[model samples]
Target: MITENQIHSLAKRWEIDQITVMREYLQILFLFYLYAQRKSDKIFFKGGTAIRFLFGSFRFSEDLDFTGTLESDEIIGLFNNACSDLNREIPAVEMENFKKKRNSIVSRIRYTPKPDTYPLGIHLEISIRERPITKAASHIETLLPVSPYPVVTHLESEEIMAEKIRALLKRAKGRDLFDLWYLLTKEVKLNWDMVKKKMEFYNDAATLTDLVSAVKAFNQKKLFDDLAKFLPRAQRKTIPGLKENILEKLGRFAVT
Candidate 1:
């Protein structure tokens, strides 16, 4: 169990709120649990959380996302075991709900430290797929420097970027745009072959030009409002201009 003091220290070091720090703490704990049960090999981490934890993206993510080939029963069992292990380590943590959907398993966890306050909840979403389109997995270290846990196996950065591009075209959420912008700014090359493959999977024939046009039509006000909650207070004020900036830079990298 990570002590409150240690979590506070980490929050200070990361310059984020204590609740966000605790969420990340639990995420690491869950990752360690998966490693302990050897189920880590069956899953491939992706999405915004992976971008932050694995590749040092500046934006903070709430849910932990993964794509794995495991069956629902197997994934549920694995999560059950992981939750049991997490509870054994930190009795305050509890798995409140486990809902099995057609293509995903959603787990809601609650951390109840005191009787006076409401428990903090965190959500983990695991998408059950046949397998990763790109088998580009690698072992990588997490951002937590003091932890001695084994390296996590996740999708490679380029593959993650491709997925981010897929997400940008598929969803209206502002975070996808933000993530793509960050990846492009870092000069991370997008794997166009993988991107095309993902598009084929969805039966979408949208080209780079089409995607750029869609991005240009995004409602800036809605984007600003949607992304404001995830950013730090100092950064929140800049969201109003983020849409324009992203559109201006979109042309530079949205190339074949």
Candidate 2:
């Protein structure tokens, strides 16, 4: 159990804003719960946001991505009806916020500000087709698939999401340096190898290649040097397989 004192110590020691970010995270989870209870006639495609809610970050996600399902049309989407059910001030709001698209990813978001410290926003994206599932790794623990969306699987555990996210941080470093640091410092790491293997299962070549690229940038900026100095004792105890291996890999890929 992470005690309050421990968290405070880690925050001050690591010089990271982990707890403040997590407080914001709980609000996003609330928004996801709003949609998961949907019973609309339209087939809504659910993926990234849901996965993030179930497994990913403890911070506000700027981009919400989704795909419309096998049976869907554009004229009238589920946007309005879902908001109406929730009594949002505006039935819905529309935006063209996606930076770019690859393979029919549709994003729709409506912000309904709550009377709270942090404003609450609702975002929905529908992918018309399902994401191509990577072959399952032996390490991944698969729960019984959700019947509504067989393609959607709860990552057997939180650790699974942590490791994959860590690897992703490395790959996405510098390109979106802020997101990388957020994932590394904020999320809990239970089983890094499982996360690493699960990512490999999804796309081995891309993951490995991106990993090299991300770490190189990390090294150039001495990111891990900062991490090594401040990682909490509890976190140090949990990241089992990746201690020297990850550090060595980071060294090898280090930019110099």
Report the number of the highest-TM-score candidate: 1
TM-score of predicted structure 1:
0.87
Tens-digit lDDT track for model 1 on 1-256? 5677887886776667888877777877777776566666777778887887777776777777888777777777777788888899888888866787776788887888888889888778887853576545444455553266645667777777777888778886888888777777787876677788777776775677766776788788878867766666677777777767766776676454
Q: For each candidate, what is the lDDT?
A: 0.74, 0.37
Best by lDDT: 1
TM-score of each: 0.87, 0.40
| Model 2, span 1-256: residue lDDT tens | 2245654654555444544333223224323333444433223322333334444432224344443333443312343443343343233223334332443544444433344434334444544443322222111111112122223222233433343455455344221332333333443333445545545653643344465455444543344333322233344333233333444544443231
